[model samples]
Each structure stands twice: as C-alpha cells, then as structure tokens.
Target: MFNDGSHGFSAQVSTSGFNRRRFLGGGAAAAAAAVVGPALLAACGSNAAPGSAPAAAPADDGAPATGILRVSNWPLYIADGFVAEFQKASGLTVDYREDYNDDEEWFSKTREPLSRHQSIGCDLVIPSETIAARLHRLGWLNDIRESRWPNKKNLQPGLLNANIDPGRKFTAPYMSGMVGIAYNRAATGRDITKIDDLWDPAFKGKVSMLSDVQDSLGMVMLSQGNSPETPTSETVQKAADVVREQQEAGQIRRFTGNDYASDLAAGNIAVAQAYSGDIVQLQKDNPDLEFIIPESGGTLTMQSMVIPYTAENQKAAEAWIDYVYDRPNYAKLVVFTRYIPVLTDMTDDLNKLDPSAAANPLINPPQSTLDRVKQWPALSDEQTKEFASTYAAITGG
Candidate 1:
C-alpha cells in the first residue's frame, strides 16, 4: 500500500506481481499535490473542505444488515486467503477493490458525492492519517465505536486517543510505518542512529530529508527534545528553521519523496529521512542499507480503515474490522504488508506465521523504538498553513 502522499513507499512484496515503481508513480504525484491539495480544496469552497462545518452524523435507522460489503483500499495492501476466510466465517460477501491508489485523487473523485451525503460506493476505505483526519472533520465518516467491534481493544495502547479520532470513533488503523533516518552503511562508514546525525559535517551535501512538512519537521522537532504529538506554531517554526539552516549550509542535498530510496541505494546519498518500509524493500537489493527510528524519536504514520457516513453495509464493515483485529488474522496480514502491525501482543502470532518478518526490526520494532515513535497531531487548517508556508519557503516547493 502507498501511504499518504507525503510518505510514498510500496508495501507490496515482489511476488505480488505489482510493479513497485508503477505504484510509486501515483504516490509521488499525490505527494506533490498533498503539499497544496488541502488549501486548494478550502479555497474552492468544497463541501469536503477541511475546517468546514462537519456534516451531521448519520442516524442509525435500525436498518437490516446488508449481506454485501464494499471496501476500497490501496493496491496489494491485504494478505490473500483472509478475505475468503472472512466471507466463510461471517457469511457476508466482500466486494474488495484495490483502487485507492492516491489520496488526492481519491478525495477529488469522492468529495462531490460525499458532500451530497451519497455513498462513494464503498462501505470501507483505507486512507492515511492526514486524509482520515480531514474526512472526520468533514463528518463524512460513521463512528465505528457505536458498532459491535470487540476487537477494538486490540489496538495498540499508544494508538488510542489519536488526535484525529479522540476515541477512534471514526477510523481503525490498518497498518503503520515510521519516518526516520535510512542510510547506506558503506557510504556513511558507520551507523546513523540519531536525528542530528544528518547534520554531521562528514555527510554534508550527502543527505536528504522528506519534502512533507509534518514528516521532515516532526523529526527535527524530536532532535530538539520537543514532541511532535503536541506541536505549537512556535515549535513547528523552530523545526523549519533548522531545516532552512541545513539547506543553506549545504548540509541537506535535497528534499525528496520516496525517490530518496533510489539515491541511498546507489550511493548517491549517504543518509536520508526515509520511510521504514521503503528501507525494508531496499534491503533486498542492498543489505548495507539500514533504517532506524532516531534515538530522539521518529514520526508514525498509519493507513486507517473508515466507513463513509453514507455506507450501505455498516454491520458488515464492522465485522471486517473485528475479523482483522483478531491477533491470528492480523499476523497473516503483517507477512504481506511488511510494515508494522497495529495490534498489541502480535509478536508471538506473527512469529508463528512468518518468522523472518517477525524478526525484522522494521516490521516489528523493539519496545524501546516503539516508545520513541510519535504521531503528528491533527493540525487545524490554519495551523497546517502556518507550518506548510514556512517549510515551503525553505524547500522552494
């Protein structure tokens, strides 16, 4: 699965028969749009615009359960066989489609219909954190907390009370990834373990940072002993100042999306702010490449499943969420996703399924690393602009 445009990394395995670069293309394009997409939507006075009055929550009409459920997710996001098993166990047919390729594109296509309180033809959709927050603010999603999903307790304790969904009323995390330093050990000639290491004079002009404001700035904030989970405009500006200083001093070679992976692999750059899963994939070709959650900390990004307010099969959608939250079932998913699993107590189950995956730190990070990872808070539109404008001026985006 390609995450929110800002973090474009392929989660698909090679055997899945999908072209990684092809998926990267859509993701890259979306990343470019993400820089300005939200502002543009607000300017156009779109009903789904961020900060607009949230649409009224849909009332439960005591409607009968729809026998069929529709889910739209990023391509190659889910493991096979589980869907078949889910159908057999729940007695509900699933119309699952992997058409959610880009966040900006999906929003553009569904906004008009969703604004009119009409279904986007999906009972469930998987969107990255930023997009999920936008939908929640627009009141376009149903509150799953009202459903009978007992497995909601399986959610990682750290993930509870997300800034976007205070009680996870609207969304459930599908999978997660960390944004941190990825380095070519041969180029660095040593291990890169902390966020400030990117500023070392030895690696000047051989380092890259993500172009996404939240990601790049989040990591920088951590290095300053600040937490991104509760950022203020002042802290964001402080972080952006660091980035500008690094860029002007020739410490940062460039700002990039997932393309940083290629540069790191070919020895064009020694270190980069990179996605965890991308490094997992790159390690296949270059064992020297290593991804680390900076000792200071790193940002966590989640692709979450949500039911649109107008979905027709609410009951079936809740069933699917429950089914996947089951530890044994989620372990099967981690083998395919190769990203961090969202459920707690998953290590033993995952080890039983794919011992290699369970052993990979990128897939199942140690407790110390998890302790340092934090999610960027849900920024209001004004707060977003304050952060984006300053960061954009420095990056020339």
Candidate 2:
C-alpha cells in the first residue's frame, strides 16, 4: 500500500507500513524504469481485445440501485466513518476496496479486462491525473454528468474545468497535495524556503529528489522560471540539465519516491523533494521536519474519481460523488485524510475541526501559495516517453 514513487496526489500516501524510503532501498532505478511501458499503453485506447468488437457501455438497468457500489481507492485513504455514513444516507451497500496502489500495477491488472469490454468489477476508481488521462483517451470512463450532482457547485472553480478532463465530464476531484521541499530543521541548520535550496553545497550528498519524473522535473522547471502548463522540448531539457548536474556533482544522494519521508524523518537526509500530506503526518512524530511550498512555485498533484466504461451502476457512482462533495461529509474527509480540500467553502469548518491542519501551509496554503500552484498538463505518448526516458537516464535506470 506504500505509494512512495507512485506519484504524489497527497501527503497521506507516505506512512510507516508503506514507507517510500523502504521501497527505494530495494531498487529505485529498476522501479523507475518499469513504472510504465509501451505495451501497457497500447491497451489504453482500445475498447476490446484486438479483432474483437468494441464492448458496449453498460446499460442503466433501472432496478432500484440495490447492490453494493464497489469502489477501488488507495490504501487507508478514506475516513473511518464516512463509508458507514454514506451507506446510511443512500440505502445502498458499499464494497470499498483499497486495490489501487501503484498506477501502473492497477492499469496492468485491469487493462485486458477493460480492453475486452469486460467489467473490472468496480463501480468507481481513483487514478492519478496522468493515468486518468490515459483512461479518458481510451474512452473507458463514464461521462460524469455534472448537472446531476447538485453538490458540484461547491467544488473550487479552478478544478471544475481541468486541463485533461475539460468541464470535468469524466473525472471528479477527489484528493490533492502539493509537491515541495521537506527538510529536517536540525539537519539543514536553517529553514528551507525554495527549490534552489536542494542544491546548497552544505547539504550536498545528503539530499534526495523524487524518482517520479513529473514531480522532480516539473518542480525544477518552476524553479528556473519555466511553466509546465505548456511544456516543450526546450523547457524539459532545461529542467533535466539541473537534475543531471546535481546528480553528477554528488549533491543528490539518491532519486527517491515517498521514501524521502523516511530518510528525512530519520535525519539521514537533510532536504528531500517531499509531498505535503506525508510531511504533515511525519511532523506529528518529528516536528522539526518542515514541508514548504517554495516562494517561487510548486506542483499540485491530484487523484481524481472516475467511473470505468464497464461499470453498470453509474447512478450509484454519481450518488457517491455527490455525497462526498457535500460540505459536512467533505469536512470529515479533510480532517482525516490531511490532504488539500477541494471545497473552497469548507475552510472555516476545517479550521474549527483541526486548527493545526488549517495552520499548516502544506495542507492549507495561503492565497499567494495557491495562486502559484500548477497542475501538470496532460501529456501525449511522445511527450510521456521523452520525459520518462530523460529522467530514467539520470536515475541510472
């Protein structure tokens, strides 16, 4: 259930039993090399196995929606009581499963079934934006009719029309976290304020960057005054050069995933490219470890909810989405998950529930910080390959 190198959607992803630091020790390079491949991506846009007819979307069999609404999400993501409360409100059963860990792993397991137009045996699933974009392109998800969900009005205006799922017709905002520098105060001997701090000679050979190409490279690009919103060969190369120079100079100890949290917490590394949610949790044990969104900018990584093309219970899926967006329920989720809340209106209530969370810039960054937060653009096959290959080379994959 550890999502260390999996890609940051939130801080809650890096934790004890599923520490990213532990996963990195096994084989950081090997893991990065195989995170995604051409063979798996080939399954993306096909609706059925080759030579077979594309499977039809599941029909809405209007029998009073009674069966369990199956949901696949990351491990330990949801709040303790939300499921039971949701069940009570809707009079439907929930078969929520934490079967999704690594994005590639989930895609591999379900691709053939989805490609063959067969059910992956779930009504709703959470996939990071990058993977979700693949599912969207493959025409494998239900068009989330926003008009039906009254609570959709409560969503932050910016998220309503994502770059990948314009108008959010196929995806709904679930959870999000910022990617930035997390450093142990005692180790760094000073507060780290920007992405450039990772290169400080004093902390050389005691720093780590995420192995995830997008998080590491994208953040670097922002530091150099480039925007990932309209990425190109030149901008990406600029970012790659920065990473390579540090690696070659021995300033970077290793390319990490969520495992950076473990190293930073143990005082093994001074500064690490870290996720906001993970550092929030880590601080409970070691207050000296601070997560910062650089003064210049940072990336806002997100995981969104979507209904697979093969799912039959579309109504139930929509109901669940609407149910969670309701302010009261969402407040509970924000307090429990410790990720950035998409409901802009719930800030006051959340502050009342957990003042510390509201105060933490990582969880609830100020207006200026939010303005600088940027989401990764949806990449085509060529762009994806280029960035991945470039990053893999630096990691020695």
Candidate 3:
C-alpha cells in the first residue's frame, strides 16, 4: 500500500553512526513478518530466516472485509489506487480521511481524541516531523513491536535516527523529504536558489507559502543563518521580524494550508513555497512547475506511519505498515513522487519499476545536493506559538 510518496516525508542523521539506527519494516512487510513473529502480530506464519512473505498467511485475505482502519492524512497526499490495493491484498476496508490539514490541526485532533481514548477515530495516521516528536512525547501513540514488523530491517539509517520518534519506537517512517519552493520556469525568469528570491519583484503577488508556523518561519530563519535546532531568543525574534516584513511588503500572494498546490498550478503564484514531495506530482502534470531549495537552506522533515494507542486493528495495521517499505514497494514510490527514497539500495528496484522515473533528479537527487539539506529541530511549544503569531502578522493573515 503506497501513494508514490507525498505529504510529509524526510531523512535525518544523528550524533551516532549508522547501523544502530533502526529500520522497523520494509515494503510488503509480509516478507519480514516471519522474523518479528506472532507476538508482534497475529503469529500465523512459520518462522523461516526472513525475506519472503508467508504463503497463505493469515494477514493476506486479498478480499474486502468489514472492519476499517481510518487513515488520516493531509488532502490528496498519496496517489490513488493504494487503498484499493491494500484492501484487496489484505481484505480490510479503509476509512481513509484527509483530516490532517497541518501540524497544529492534527496535533489538536490527536490530543483531544486520544486523551478521552476516542481514537482520533483513526488507527493509522501520518504526521509531520516536528509534530511526531510532540505526539511521541504526549504519550498518544503506540510502541514499536519489531516482531509485528518483520521488514523493519530495510529502513534507512537516516530515518532510523529521527528524534521525532527517536528509534521510531512509536511509528514507522512513512515518507522522508524536504520543504522548499516550486515555481513556473517561464514566469520567474530568475532561478530560485535563495530565500530572498521569493521577494523578487518578478514574484510580487505571485509567491505562495505554507500556512504553518514551523516551516514558514523556519525557512526564514535558515535564510538568515539560523539553525532551527534550537532557535535562540534573538533568532526567534529575528524570524518573527522577517515574517512580519514579508507580509507587510505584500510579497506573499497568500498563505496556504493545503491549497498551495492549486494556487501554484492555476498561475495564481509564479514562485511557490512547498514541500518537495507536494510539488512533485504538479511538476509531472505541469512541466512549467519546477522546485528549488533556497540559497541558504531548506527545512528537512519526515512524516511517519503511526499506530495510535486506540487502534483497533493492530495486527492488520502492523501487516500493512510493513507493506509500505518492502523493497519493491519502496522502489515504486520513489518514482511516482520524485522525493528521494530514504533507503539507499533501492536504485535497482527503482530502475526496474520505471527507468524514466529513476532518472528524474527530483525523484533521485545526485549525492552532492542531498548532503546540503538538513533537518530542522523541533521547536518547543512556546517557539511554535511565537513563530505562528509572528507569521500571521507578517502575512496579514
């Protein structure tokens, strides 16, 4: 079950070296299910070494069933046909809803629903990186059960070390990517490589940005040489100043929650601020839409597959989680979305799935560019609030 990688996805490195970083599952996790054993899942398969799905395993129903796993996400994040495939393969119906608008919206929903044990009414959900840390800290999520996810080993080290889910104990890496800008090459005669470019006269009333506090402000701070790792008091104030200025200058055409894509596509904005994955599909559909990182830096993030504490179908949910990372599936996703795959070894499988997709730099970047990107630190609640207020004033929102 995959959507060619969209919504929020990214990779992260850590103080520690590779190998210790943990990968909890591979695509088609059924292949790795045997290693995790039934304790982590329903335990209907024989324990062979690993690497193959159990034949006639209880998890593979291959027909639609009655129960549902309400999957919540940002609207139009994943490609079509995935829910159908997962339902067809596992025989479980999906009450898939696009309720996650932004970090704050999803965080609010989870806190209220999970606090009363109302389940957020969704068993599996995807949350952006910074919020993932918050969800894990708030104790609203489930713990990682390696046995339930036999394919965990295939995950890349960068994903393994994300502080958001530290060790990914509560969730699996859904998709890993960056947040940057997308523009129409024909409209913005200048190539956009720096943050100041968004304010260029050419993009006046033609630039768009995310409606979130973390990324919008974080990008501004990075452009000013600030690491989002822990925004100092002065740095925080400076970021707010930048947002206020941008809004006052009429530089931003509009701030968006999810409609950022539509605005960019309709030519409402010539240069668009966006997540690399979000604009990937738009680029394919509209050749004029091209994306670039700001000259200073970009905000790196990871969105993950988390099983809420109130999940009713943990067994089936675990089985399906594995399906997202299996080698073949992982390879398939890299092509459709054009976001770099966190798993390095996927080149072969990716080529097999689609040669042209593999060649797209947006899908698989050259090693040099990947090295320059960095993950922003999760700001404390105070920081988030301060930035949001500052940005609202700047964007006149």
Q: Which of the numbered candidates is closest to the native, going by highest lDDT? A: 1
Q: Which ten residues in a row have the lowest lDDT in candidate 2?
A: 17-26
Residue 376 CA error for candidate 2 (Å)? 0.9
Give the per-residue Cα lDDT of candidate 1 at 224: 90
How many steric clashes does model 3 contain?
A: 26
lDDT of 3 by residue, 2-85 (tens): 123343331111101011111111111211221222222223322321222211223434442347777876554454577788
RMSD, every candidate, angstroms: 4.6, 4.9, 12.6
Per-residue lDDT tens digits of candidate 2, residues 1-397? 2344444433344542243223211233433433354355454655332223222334545444566799998876788789999999999999999777666667778877786668899999987777777777666777766555778888888887878878777888887788788899999899999888988999989999888777777778888889887788889889999999999999999987676766788788999987777777677668898887788788878878899988877888888999988987888887777788887767687777778777777777776777788887777767776777787788874
Sort the predicted structures by TM-score, highest score first: 1, 2, 3
lDDT of the candidates, in the order given: 0.78, 0.75, 0.61
TM-score of each: 0.88, 0.86, 0.69
What does the lDDT come to for candidate 2? Answer: 0.75
lDDT of 1 at 226: 87
Error of 2 at 393 (Å): 1.0
Whole-structure CA lDDT of model 1: 0.78
Q: Which of candidates 1 and 3 is the stronger one according to lDDT?
A: 1
Sort the candidates on lDDT, descending order. Answer: 1, 2, 3
